[model samples]
Target chain A: MIEEKDRTLKEKSLEKAPTGINGLDDITYGGLPKGRTTLVYGSAGSGKTLMAMEFLVKGAQKYGEPGVFMAFEETAEDLAENFASLGFDLDGMESRDRLLVDHVHIDKSEIEETGEYDLEGLFIRLGLAIDSIGAKRVALDTLEVLFSGFQNEAILRSELRRLFRWLKDRGVTAIVTGERGEASLTRYGLEEYVADCVILLDNRMEEQISTRRLRIIKYRGSKHGTNEYPFLIEEDGISVLPITSLSLEHEVSTERISTGISRLDTMLGGQGYYRGTTVLVSGTAGTGKTSFAAQFCKAACERGERCLYFAFEESPDQITRNMKSIGIKLQPYLDSGLMQIHASRPMAYGLEMHLMGMRKILDTFNPDVIVIDPITNLISAGTEIDVKLMLTRLIDYLKLKNITAICTSLVQRESTEGINAQEISSLMDTWINLRFFESNNERNRGISVVKARGMAHSNQIREYMLTNHGIEIRDVYLGPSGGLLMGSSRDIQEAKETAEIAAQSKNAARRKRELESKLKSLDAQITALNSEFEVQKEELDKLSSEEALRSNALAKDRSEMARIRRADLH
Target chain B: MEDAAQNNNGPELVESDTTPDPEFYILRLYVAGQTKKSLTAFANLKEICEEHLGGRYRIEVVDLLENPQLARGDQILAVPTLVRRLPPPIKKIIGDLSNTERVLVGLDLLPVGEANVQK
Candidate 1:
């Protein structure tokens, strides 16, 4: 039994204890060692209490590891009530006795720390608390509160050291949270040094934007994240994102999907483009830029794929109605939540706020395709530098997340105004130019795929038409008359007249050939009739002569030899 | 305990807000050599001081090449360490100050905080 006890103690000395918090372990590289205390220092409203509770809750709930929480700041009832609001069943865990929330009331008025008095009483209480539940994890929340009444730093520091060492000796992984000091990482600098690991949480407010930053100041035996990481505190709990730096090695699907309009997809390679690629359609006003964007979104929605359309120029309702005229029905998809149309003027908010709103919406919806119709409008509200920076961040974010982002830019033909032309072109994976070219005395909107990275696309400027039916691409309209070059009313009129004349000549030639064949057949029939007539006349003459001979014979026989004539007539 | 903390307060030196030390400066120039580059750097710095820091600044030029031992006193490693010791926090800029905008921004003369866009 003695040998077994020593073996167990040796095992306990080497085992590492996990902090059991969702993302905290990842940040700490692994976790704090078992039986070692970690100091969690942060200012008020910095999620100190939440982190402590999460550590304990994860231990008790997930690992089936019992825990002890001694709160010097809040009563057990108060802690339990706070947990109830967060939907954490603290009472249920307490009933199972796998968890214990102990309230240590250390009133400044009654406390006295003398030199001879060792922290044996406090140690005894902690031991009893851990022993009762066989707890492996312990939390002493806000140890700084004990120093509120004490003026001597040396005494407080020694007491903290004793507390941490006692907890370690008891073989329990302890978390001791404290308030941040003005200059030091923690209230009592000694606590940070004595603890096995130290984590600093900062709830900072800059430009009215509240952000929480977590940094691990020190970890004795383990490697940890030393940089400040941004974390989000929501109703559920804290979520830490390390700002995923994406690698270009992630696999992408090369299969093409139709863009609803067969002509549009045909212009973009045979079928369409690979998924998760940004497509930029830039043009001047009234070049069917929005129509082209709407076509892709409509196609995605039709395929039961989710699409998010951000219309900066038009409202969602107006876009829906306008699309209806072009036979692009989006209402059904909107009703099904598969299509989300978000519309707002560019001047409605700042550039960063707009980007943040887009980010929030993206996180919530996670659609397959995202469309930012006319990004120039959104960027025009900011300075060139701000626009470039925001676009860089947004594009980088999209590429990292592998989201297919399409942006339409309205390039004014009269004025060369855009959001940093260099960056706009550089950031886009593909750029499609839509221009109105004069053809046959009429203005024709020409759609051409200028560049598609890693894919082949038709380079010809196909004539595009937007009618009541939908968008259409006419055949490569090329002719020797150069009707496309000389686009005027007279040119169109001449072309139309020329087409009419050509059709008339084709029909006249067909009619003349038919008449010539019929006349030849009629002449052959007339010759055949003449030949038959000649033969019939000969036969008729033969028959008539015979009858004449018979009559003459009969007459001769009657006049001379009646008997011979009668025999000849017979 | 407060007395003990006081005992370990290192050196007891009362610094004034008005009087400037020989090494301290409202304006300062730090150089390492008399090379053409360093001479041009000193000339440019002197011109800036005469223009912007004429009345308010008392320029103190520290040549590290002449007194290398003084480098340790100011914890200097690079050639030029312009310490604004007259002002609190003693802002230091180590360069020839050829890029005016960078010097201004790095010296806190220009507002380049995260919340503020310099451009």
Candidate 2:
């Protein structure tokens, strides 16, 4: 028997029950210890009950492991009502024999302990509930109520210790929710008995914004994430986002994707931003940041790639309409399901909540690229330092997922904008800074690639005009002061240069015409000389014939012979 | 979801909501098994009822080992507990009920001003 026990212990080191939460499984290495009690301690309204319920429900629904939820404080009906909004059908599961719920409520005002007793009744009820569904998981939410309800501490403590032992013997994973104590993990120090695992949930309100965070205090015989993971009690269930100051180990790609504009693509080393890289587009107001992002989205959609756009400043319709004027039609991509726009007020949620929501979307949509229009607007959601940290984690997460991200930041104050952009740029793989050039009594837009990792990007601050047709990157034209000109002055300079070129070409054509006329007169003189020579030759022939006729009269007999000879020759 | 919960929970509520009669004394003795402690608790409860109120009291002994579902109705936790069901306010007394004086006071048979707070 001793050998068999040793074999069993060696074979099964430590079994786990997967909670089936998104990132929770990754952090815990699996889940809570199997066939052991895990104490979850937290203050009131700290989402302890929700986490325990989700653990039971998700175990039943996903892993086919039936569960039991024995509420110590709230009634079964109240628990059911609370879970309804989250779309967990408790009654339906109970009917399907997948779950068993029983509320153990005790009124201290009514009950009187006359003599000594043991909690055998509770044990029997709990045992019956578990056996009814063949449960593999159990949750006793808000179990601290027993201490307050019962007057016998010795008996209650003994019975609790016995209950935990019974749960382990039954080989059922159990979660016991306890209220946070001043110095102990639980108000009643239940963690002493529950020695396998302990998780703490904290809800803190900062700057009128509340954020929920979770941390694992201890996990025996396991390696778990020790950071405070922010979780969301959102629809479908509690999703614990297990993020730490993750090690820089994300794989990078040398492949590039276009920036949509042909010239912008060329400016970015005749290609564009690298795949799985973060690009920051920082500029002042009305510098066409949103338009640039939309153009990138259009190009991605044109290549049949999906893009997720998060717009914190404008509505979806407003962005679509505004992009339409720049000759970038985003409505088609939206209709074709190639692009998705999630617009929300930055301050509507806390920074952690925003990160959680974005992670959820990234998981569900699995988009190839994401565009956050004006990430600087998140300042309203959190402090500057908080925003920077969130951005850093977000950029790292995108890189780890090999997702391309384009973040637009609004430079509100000129004085501090440089430092602000630099803080975010340190995390970005490429930085494209757009500025408004005040030239010719007007504000004109100019674009420059401040930095691009592993590429020979353009260094020129080229002028880009936002026309009704599209954005046009004009050639560099220097003003009279030898500086790069832009706007109407650049246009006037280009027109003047064109007119000068036209006059120079016209003068060359006039000179060629003059030379051609001179050549024509020389040819006419040669033709006149040839015609005079022909006329002179004809007159000499006539004079020779007259002289021969006078000589023929003197020698009539010789002329007759010459006439015959001439006739024969003719 | 709320409708389903209410419908499923309707029968349990009705089953536990027995008709209330103030004059009648209804006592339920809950025990885990047929152990010595459980038998002693039953005997003591019967003796107390016979002497205090005669035929006006009705006693129901629930063996939780056999009928575990019955424990949920009275919110039973400790074994050998006596629950006063018919009284306006329900009261529970734990232990084997050997202390007759305390049992009488707990059931209001002695007409005491208040029961022991235990704290």
Candidate 3:
């Protein structure tokens, strides 16, 4: 017996019940303390009753734990109809003997006490309902009505305490919802009685945008996340986006994958992106950020991998049509179920709800690559810090799942100071910046690799053109003045070079003709000089012959005496 | 005169008469346990009954600690309450029945002159 007492003291054996709400169990570490009452207080339309009902329904459906919901504000039929839209068939659960919904009507004026009274009637009815379904979970929605019915605070307080104790003694996890008070946590300050756990739901509108937030005020005997989480009421039910509470223990991948654009891949160290890493494509409007992301999606689909594209600015059909204009055919992938494009306006929900919705769809689709085209649109839905925190969780979740994510963001023109885009850029593994270079009265697109964490990337900005064949990066055009030129300017420089070369050839041809004419004249003068020399030589020969003839005639007259002259001549 | 003669005979004889015997009073004292408060209340009620009602009243004691369900029938709240159940209009006095005058007033047993003056 002493050992048993010691064990109980050391272990405490406090079990927890899972609420089955997305991200809620993560924040609570499990759920509310089992067999103990938890107070959930909120104002009107703050989703206090809906949360309580979901707890019971999810308990019955998912965890196989039967539940009893005793509603004081709304009827059982009303609750059934309200929750049916969320796909929670409360009536079906009732027919299967898994749930019991009991509505208690309390009218203050109808109750009259002659002498003494306890809430034995309520106790008996609640007990019978619990026993009828063998319920392991119980929810008493809106405990404030009891205070109105019993007009005495003393009796109501004691009865509430007794009710909580009775529920604990019955060994069933119970949820007690109360309306928010002016200053206290509950209308009657019932938070003191529900000592195990207390959760507060707040609904507020800021700047014409409504946001629903939930916080766990206190939890006993267990560690829980104490942060304000945003939740959404959707077709599936309440989904809580627990930002900053998730631990950063996701696995990292080292494999490289394609970015779909081969030239862009070459710019990114010749291999593309590392698997399971975040890539940020930030650019101003009309810079083809979405088209670039679509290229990545196309590559992923061609590899027979699943891709999910979240478009906040355009519809799926619109994106498909727009991408088609750029020669990227996403229709086949969409038809083949390899790609899913989910489009919704950022104003449709708060940042955290969008995160939760993305998480839900991600879990269902289980894609290899995810794209959020222009995450900047989310800036209008929340503050910078809120968007940053949400994106951080989203990136962390994707990395943990070993899924590669490419997020595009639009930077405002004339300003490179987008706080959200800059913050997200710091968290990304690779950052690709796109801009427009205006020259020659036309704007030309340019893409530059700003940062790549673990690999070498090109530092030069490559001019890209979005032609009918898709995005193509042209080679670097170095001008004669040592500046990089693109598009029409490069063409103009090439044309100038051609004209300069043609003029130089024409001058060379004229100089060659002049040189040839001078050479011909010089050749004629040389020949005439040679002929004069020849004529002079001929005249000299003729003069010498005449002289010789005169000498010969003289020699003939003196022939007799010429024997001596001939002998001398011989 | 016949009701007066039956009431003078005995309280049991008044039970058999049953012809609107307004003189005969029936009182029930509800107690939770044999505590000092319950005993004092019982003593006080017995004394008041013998002095004021003489043999014209019948007394019954109910212990709620033994059978708690009986408290609901009369809507008993506090312990040791004296209930005047025999009269057509039932009345109750709570808290150990210490105030005899108030208890008498509550039970409609005051003298005619004082009752008329109080009214």
Candidate 4:
């Protein structure tokens, strides 16, 4: 029993080969099963050939493993030209003795079979190519052409089995691409023969928008992601956007960064956003969502940190021209190599492609912060679920890398009830809402912090104005009516208070003049009464002197009668 | 008779000495393991050669089970296949040669009118 368990564990530990595509290796844990045949089936234009070629090119270029590509559909020269746009120099790799491209042409009309035959010619050719290049990897593009070439199904089936067994015995990993069938994974049901691993590629159209998706149907002995991943085909070639690690094991940061506007910073707990957290700035049209994001980007650039700004709705030139009106000079930052503005229409590619492009830029630019202006425009490119899944992966990847990201979403004007925020609010660490508040026959911009995780934020809605000097948040005007007033309403309220103060001052001046006149009249009355009293006193004194003189004369006559009395009086 | 012919020497002969005609029929039969189909195809081919060309025909039988490496020369894909190498245009017919009319038609031995009637 113990031995059986050990054997099972060993079987589970089957080796894998790296596909060398950007996110595919992570999904398959490594890549297709190593030294085994892996069937990659998809419809036309679904990037099957490109994926196979990239696997070979990357194998030779990055992994130091030589590869042989036997194309049954396109010639080597045609393939070289086809891949030239992606900068894959097949001829160069060929000359280096690390790659071999052999085109196997099988026209049924030209081939005449007589006696017993297997696909020995093919086996010999493949064997020579592999031996010539010492290839560790082999890719047979469009392996279904054999079905058209050979009429005997039994012979074809047995030969294919032999071919796969030969490839395995040679100890070379092989990838065989097949056309998608109506009911089976491959046109000829080749998956049944080469079933070590199977990957299905699909291109679907939804609402006139096309999206390419990839799913791993089976992996023989290893644990792999079973989700359908969105893949993109661009100038760099096909890239699969695998979901990042789902575990929340990423490190968190307590450090803060400025949001460029001082008032806005104060509203977010007196500091800016967290170093590696996601911030959602949601607002309706004309609510300065782009301007707010630009402010954050400018702040990051000014601090000598790189910032990547993805503009979906507007061209880079348009963004630059519009931002200049708000006093943000992105040109300097761009010229200094601290900021990069990548602008493209949301309809230009699928959501996963956009994510892949962003990831490529992030790796090459190594930005400290990333800004997606009006992320809601991406909703038009995919379903709500697709966009949400992409954003989740993006946010998770950014967090894992310790890179701060600011995403602005344009909410519909009619749904001012926070429905848009409700969609992505749970995914963000901070949410700031902007709205157009109309008051006193004028429209004014208002900004409020909806939520800031792990920090305290102001709950008051501040009226902000987007002027030539940038965004400025105004203090709430508490009027007599008890609600915050803004725009022309605040101006009218201020004018009314000024008029009332002026009238009260005028009444005080008139009262001062009347009191001065009354004091003057009282002083004059007192002076008149004093003068009357002085005149009466002078008359009384004269009367008293006269009486004294008469008394003296009487005393002299009496002194004659009595000489002794007179002498006593003298 | 087919088993005895399997050991016949010299499979690369241009023609049999008994018939020096330039228009002689050159035939080769491929088989594996002397199966029932191989015996029937060989017997049918011999009867057709006897009745059609007589001394002007040559037959070479190759057993692929004994020599698998020779399977690549004629692009052989199935057992019990007959190849007509001589006539300017080469032809191939698969399966056991049980239907004499198809064999004759496939090998281009029947008269033009009879082949048309068979078709």
What is each candidate's DockQ, to 2 decimals?
0.01, 0.60, 0.04, 0.11
lDDT of 1 by residue, B14-110 (tens): 4233344433336455556665545665666676666655455566676655544344334343344455555555665544566555555544556
Q: Which wins on DockQ, candidate 2 or candidate 3?
A: 2
- Candidate 1 lDDT: 0.69
Off by over 4 Å in 1: A1-27, A60-64, A74-98, A103-125, A149-154, A190-192, A205-208, A234-236, A243-256, A273-294, A305-322, A325-327, A336-455, A458-570, B1-119
Cα lDDT tens digits for candidate 2, B7-117: 534753454456343566778788988888888888899999999788777787778787777777557888898987656466788888988777888787775544344
Q: State the lDDT of candidate 4 residue by residue for A458-559, as single tens digits.
A: 999889988898888887788777878888887777787788899989888888878777777777777776777677777778888888988998887687
Q: Residue-wise lDDT of candidate 2 within A351-461, one digit each (tens)?
A: 767876888899889999999988877756865555666677778879999999999988865322566677788888888988888866898888888888889999998
Model 3 chain B poorest ten-residue lDDT run: B1-10
User: Which pairs clash in the backbone of model 4?
Assistant: A115-B76, A116-B76, A117-B76, A117-B77
Between candidates 1 and 4, the TM-score winner: 4
Share of real contacts kept by model 3? 0.00
Please state the error at residue A210 of candidate 2 in Å: 2.5
Task: Please list the residue runs of candidate 2 whose C-alpha ends up more than 4 Å from where it truly belongs after superposition.
Answer: A1-11, A244-280, A294-310, A315-343, A352-371, A383-406, A412-431, A439-442, A449-460, A478-483, A513-570, B1-22, B34-40, B87-89, B98-102, B114-119
TM-score for the B chain of model 1: 0.65
Clashes in model 2: which pairs?
none
Estimate TM-scores for all models.
0.53, 0.77, 0.67, 0.69
User: Please, what are the lDDT tens digits per residue for candidate 3 over residues A51-151?
Assistant: 89889989998899999998887888999999997888999999998998877766544333223344654665577678778999999988788887664
Q: Pick the candidate with the highest lDDT.
A: 2
B3 Cα displacement, candidate 2 (Å): 21
- Give model 1's docking category: incorrect
